[model samples]
Target: GVPLSTNEDSTRNQNLAALYVLPQTSYPTFYDVRLFIDPGYTEAFHGNVSIRIIPNINIDQITIHAMAMRIDSIRVVSDVNPNEDLFSDFTLATDDTHLLTIRLTRNITALQPHVIHIDYVAQYADDMFGVYVSTYEENGRTVNLVTSQLQPTFARRAFPCYDEPALKAVFRTTIYAPAAYATVRSNTPERRDSLKPNEPGYVKHEFEDTLVMSTYLIAYLVSNFNYI
Candidate 1:
């Protein structure tokens, strides 16, 4: 049996929450995210997310919320000046804290907008949670569905984000799934694929840019549900 500690040092966190949170240093303004998930093959999901942020102070470290994912590459580019990359290196604090610390070779000045682009592959939620699988009975057969629940602090389980409730921002989201799952849903309606890719056994579901909202407000589902 495991011993339980009654000490305040074991319980008290700096953020006054169960887990640590983003420091709001990089004030995120908008997010452009794309996910490639095959419902038939649900072992893992591949995706990328780019966040436009305005730091209020000059800092070399940019920390964001991330959980249950592996980061492949990261790049920081100035919004006003895109001539060179601003990213130096990155490290993931994958404890219960779920913070990704990005170190920059040079400091990003105050009030300047920069975009952080991250490419990674992430695993599906273990349980009925952030992008997990559920089942439905249809004609004496079980059908698997892929969906998401990004309430409260669960958005970080789906992607790397500033998942705080007060950090509201616009979201431009896109997804890739099998064509069999005709029903795809997001907070906003699906839009036409202006930049459609020629991926095999997959179709694109692009959604209209959502109005300014917190990360937890976003929802996505992919299933061949028999509905209008």
Candidate 2:
């Protein structure tokens, strides 16, 4: 039986959580996993990424998830001759979720396209940002508190993709998480979100996209958190 346990190492656990190991079959073997990126804010962006190809695989299905942003265009710049623009036949809009899939029609001679580039902006959210706290008092007053992992849930929540790390993609996430929240985190250290004053219970968190990574590895936890 496959071993199962709660993940402890934040980094290693994040990678493991993003992967799905399937059972062996009688014939050929292939694995299909979804991928996502948070293109924070950039006019032009480019990235190179790689994925380990499992032996005995015949094909790979590549899908891109872009939601709530304007995708002026997308083009396949490598791997194939003639540089095909595959985005035309692809689906651009989802029920508030944007998902596009492309089958690698040809065998890959090199690891490319596995690294993708994206350009987009981060929009604001009403429900996407908020403070939910659980508190208790020592003597009839409240003291303890808790906050949401709004980065993965709120920030990326607006968009739809694999939303994990093992399915790493060159993520370029530019958006507003919130202002009251001091810090934000992504797969890469590219840019930071800006803060501005707003109505009650409102702020902004704008950051740059992330590095090449699986969907699940894309994570952010915001709050006054102290790790032991």
Candidate 3:
């Protein structure tokens, strides 16, 4: 096995309870995140994340963190050729509960910008952390809401990310849900919302890009629950 760096040794277990700490070899400078909730009570929430990053060193593998998600796809695109995609030539493995190691065909240029895209189905936890379902009584009916609590290391449960408290990045987030469930909130304020024509009964709420912040500080919610 390759020797783990001090950063890795310290962060490998940084999850809410784990003790391994993953090293910081690459940094995501920006992230574009989109989520689609079932509207009804469901644990299967779809997510799409696009991240712009700069690697600290030239390397053939990219290791990040993820947990409790079913990844459908992973791809990389270089800024030099935005039209070209490098999805077919890579292998991704999430062998551990909080580790996702991606092996690429070629070495990524050191300090150069690259974009990573991931499509996945993430679970809504009952644990009340990292994109979970919340329940409450409303108007004489039991209401279920979809929300996110990414504090500490729970961000990986919602989406693939560095999952560290020190790795901060800008985020452009969007949430898709039934129009009837109108309200959505995130770390930042809403930019605009539009009907999802192809997916009837759904509206996509887009939020403005966020100030640089750690993944743990990220929060989002989709609910019909009234605000006091």
Candidate 4:
């Protein structure tokens, strides 16, 4: 339930009862997401997401949605001047669930595109939601499958995003996992896959960029299930 708006603009006038349904102040046009899953572990699936956004007005801060995820680092830089406008201030808004605010030292020009890069780790929950773990019995042994079911507003549970249907963006997603241990799938077809150098028993699978779609439509899964 992330909305985009400049800090100076105060136009969230929707009866004040449905503040959660307000439209975003910033719009995302494209995204590049990378994920690493260790199914062997019980928690902490790492991920990195890069988003290209266009704001309606000049803004010094950008806000998105996230829940039950630990943000490791956030880097925001203008495409025009990567070194000049780097921001370090990251905090949560008051009394808001899944709301993440990033304050930049300088205001970003309106209608221009800026890249927001985020590194975070999310837990694989037992419930089916954003990147959860599903279990089954294989050959009399218990097995776990790490998967996702981001529908409606659950995308924030996996990675930071607008987490609304109004915001549409193209996505390029990649996954890294132990080779031959699991199969990776996403919204788009796999573009390529290869063994990761210097890391044995690991492989990287890159997916083609998705058509412009809402965050709810974007998905990925890591599992050992075979195509029968």
Candidate 5:
């Protein structure tokens, strides 16, 4: 035999129900029951059940590439409110050619509306394609020259980010070089453009704003690389 009771709570618009079952057989038997609990069952369950709801957030794709040098490391600085770190979750790869990928972290929910800063270093390799360097034969004499126009492909061969024409972000770059190189160019106009005072052979150049662009769209060139 079973006894049932139902009551309605008008204030909360909830139905509270209870059921009592009495054993009719000598042996215990299993029974299948279904309970249609209200959507707001916190009070009825006395807060014993915990439910977690995650919001739907959009994540942007990022990619990177490196050129002319081997990338030793990549660092990602998160802009979380409590200052959380997100460097450990990024994926990095590099071949002798210019290409890298920065896979987004799975828990990108924590990085909503935040800026990520990436820093890396690369070493110069001999230009096999003569893109960054130029060669000319004058009167049967061999002349070798370097040019800055190869920045789009050569400079970007360092780290992975968005690498298309339209996908762009604000970026700041500082280039280190020997004392002879005096000129550097970036997509954005220079702001604090100067050489490192104490450091003899390093030039610290910065840009103010960058147009929306892909990672490959970023370009920089350094010539006669010298410090102050």
Candidate 6:
């Protein structure tokens, strides 16, 4: 979480346990996420997420959760400034800080909204959490399937976001996948045209915006599996 106060702030208690919890300086209101995954050709997937957040107080740093991924870029957009922020991750570091910290040159005003944009890439998880690939036999050949089980705290492994248990936001998600051989499913049914000239042989599945909900409740699946 972002450091909202300096050590001299006597009103704030710097307890030892505070290190384990995220500071609620800024919280997410919405998430717009797009993903491209072709399980037939690669194990890694690419994604871009834009998050809308509101600051509870003027803050110079923003921290959110992420794990086991490469964030190619991150930027904060607002009337104040549109430049990118310097960011670092401690997902695998000794502090057990799966937090992504973005240092800002200017402070974000309290109650003002801004968008945090990030581009990232990560391999499909083998563990049951987050977005992952599973296999099944279809006509004597192994077939790859993509699915998610983002309950509790695993959504960070899928996309960078405010991942605390109580943090909730509206989510709008999209997926680009093989058109002819794949079926996509999400919380809502809002599939669109299947072909794009720029993305040949791929289909677009844009889900409707979710209700105000926790990140863990966001779910999706990509495969040729039958819809039941």
Q: Which candidate is the best by lDDT?
A: 1
Residue 60, candidate 4: Cα error in Å is 0.7
> Which residue pairs of candidate 4 clash?
4-24, 4-25, 4-26, 5-25
Cα TM-score per model: 0.89, 0.36, 0.84, 0.86, 0.47, 0.83
**Which lDDT values do the candidates have, in the order given?**
0.85, 0.36, 0.79, 0.79, 0.35, 0.79
The TM-score measured for candidate 2 stands at: 0.36
Model 4, residue 142: C-alpha shift (Å): 0.6
- Candidate 2 segments whose C-alpha is farther than 4 A from its true place: 1-61, 79-86, 96-98, 102-115, 129-161, 169-228
Q: Give the top-scoring candidate (TM-score).
A: 1
lDDT of 3 by residue, 170-223 (tens): 988888888767778888878855422235567778888899989998888888
Candidate 4 vs candidate 5: which has greater lDDT? 4
lDDT of 4 by residue, 92-125 (tens): 5455556788888888888988999999998775
Q: Quote the positional error of residue 99 for candidate 1 in Å.
A: 0.3
RMSD after Cα superposition, model 2: 12.9
Positional deviation of residue 158's Cα in model 3 after best superposition, in angstroms:
1.1
| Model 3 alpha-carbon drift over 4 Å, by segment | 1-19, 88-97, 192-199
TM-score sort, best first = 1, 4, 3, 6, 5, 2
| Candidate 6 displacement at residue 221 in angstroms | 0.5
The Cα error of candidate 2 at residue 102, in Å, is: 5.1
lDDT of 1 by residue, 1-228 (tens): 897775675557533574575775678999998988777777888899999999989989899988888999999999778877888988888578888899998988999999999998888887766888777889999887889988878888778999889999999998888888988888898886565465777888989999999999898888998794
